[model samples]
Target: MLVNGFYSVVSWIFLALTVFAGVALVMAAIAREDAYRAASKNTKQFWLIILGVAFAIMLLVPMMFLQIIAVIAAIVFMVDVRPALRQVSGKGGGRRGSSSDGPYGPYNGGR
Candidate 1:
């Protein structure tokens, strides 16, 4: 009985983390293609943490196949989108621009 209760609690925690990571991933995707540091770095960490948490949870509770699948999906997102975003954002080095420009706008050309 005690072991069952412990696993139940763990399952709930994993479920909550899964939901949070999934939502964060969606928000990051929506904010993609932007040169903003917050969006870029956040998106990168979001996937990394997602995969990490998913793996940890799966290791702890191998019965949760859905979590495994979520990790796979996150891996795909990380590989497919993260590199292009990092290239644009320059390794989270940050860019500067006036308020008139958009969030991800390019710097002035010194014209």
Candidate 2:
């Protein structure tokens, strides 16, 4: 009844947290080591270990306390470190464009 439905909701929430941590781990791995230094963040290896443990805790640990701790680590990486790395490395996303540049390229008026 209501208990079953509550458990189902909790399961889905855990699933989402697991997936988020996994994705953060991959992102941390992809960034270059130098980028982290340039961004004044922890070394890439450190973040990888944190995120890796978080992912593992989600899968192997049944304790909600550990899962919450892991989730917090992943969220910090996503919110703080990820943005700094992207800004330093310019590889967080796809092609970049200058402020004046249009969809294709810089547009000039008839001159």
Candidate 3:
């Protein structure tokens, strides 16, 4: 009974990590290519491949070593790359009094 309970907890943890990795992969894909270059990070294509492989490993293998690598990659992208990309692309960082226009056009501030 105790062993089964422990395995259940472990399984939940693994699932959470896998989901996190998947979210990171999708974010990397949807971000602008030029933003990646402007951020001076790895090319969008390179990160796409890396995150895709990491997500695959999380989904297919679920081995500890591979999962750790995937999680690390996701963390690096989220913590370092995403923020830099956002800054370079003028999306975030809370700049005040900036134009409300988006890259393509202006919205009425969402209504």
Candidate 4:
């Protein structure tokens, strides 16, 4: 009984890791290519390939070693690359002219 319980917990953990990796992969795919270049990070295609491999490994191999590597790749992309891309792409809420700027207009305060 105890062994089976431990296996179940391990399975859940693996499943969660796989899902997280999948999310990271999708985010990498959706991000703009120019943003990656502006952020001075790896090209979007490079990251896409890395994340793609990580996701595939996570799905195909349930081994702890491989999962750890995949999780690390996902975490690196989420923590480092994603934030950089967001900053370069102006999607990080960096506060532009103002709400009245109309995305590319002159601001007039509250007028």
Clashes of each: 0, 0, 0, 0
Q: State residue 63's C-alpha deviation in candidate 1, in Å.
A: 8.0
Report residue 29 deviation for candidate 2 (angstroms): 0.7
Give lDDT tens digits, candidate 1, residues 5-105: 99999878877756655654664455444443534444545655665565556546656576667666666655655555666756643565666675557
TM-score-best of 2 and 4: 2
lDDT of 2 by residue, 1-111 (tens): 999999999999999999999999999998999999999998999999999999999999999999999999999999999999988877667777778777888766544
Prediction 3 global C-alpha lDDT: 0.90
What lDDT score is found at residue 60 in candidate 4?
93
| Alpha-carbon lDDT, every model | 0.59, 0.93, 0.90, 0.91
TM-score of candidate 1 relative to the true fold: 0.38
| Candidate number that wins on lDDT, 1 or 3 | 3
Better candidate by TM-score, 3 or 4: 3
Model 2 C-alpha lDDT versus the unseen true structure:
0.93
> lDDT of candidate 4 vs native?
0.91
Instruction: Supply the TM-score for candidate 3.
Output: 0.82
Each prediction's TM-score against the native? Answer: 0.38, 0.82, 0.82, 0.81
Deviation from native of the Cα of residue 36 in model 4, angstroms: 0.1
lDDT of 3 by residue, 1-111 (tens): 999999999999999988999999999998999999888998999999999999999999857998899899999999999999888888888645448767666657667
Against the true structure, candidate 4 reaches a TM-score of 0.81
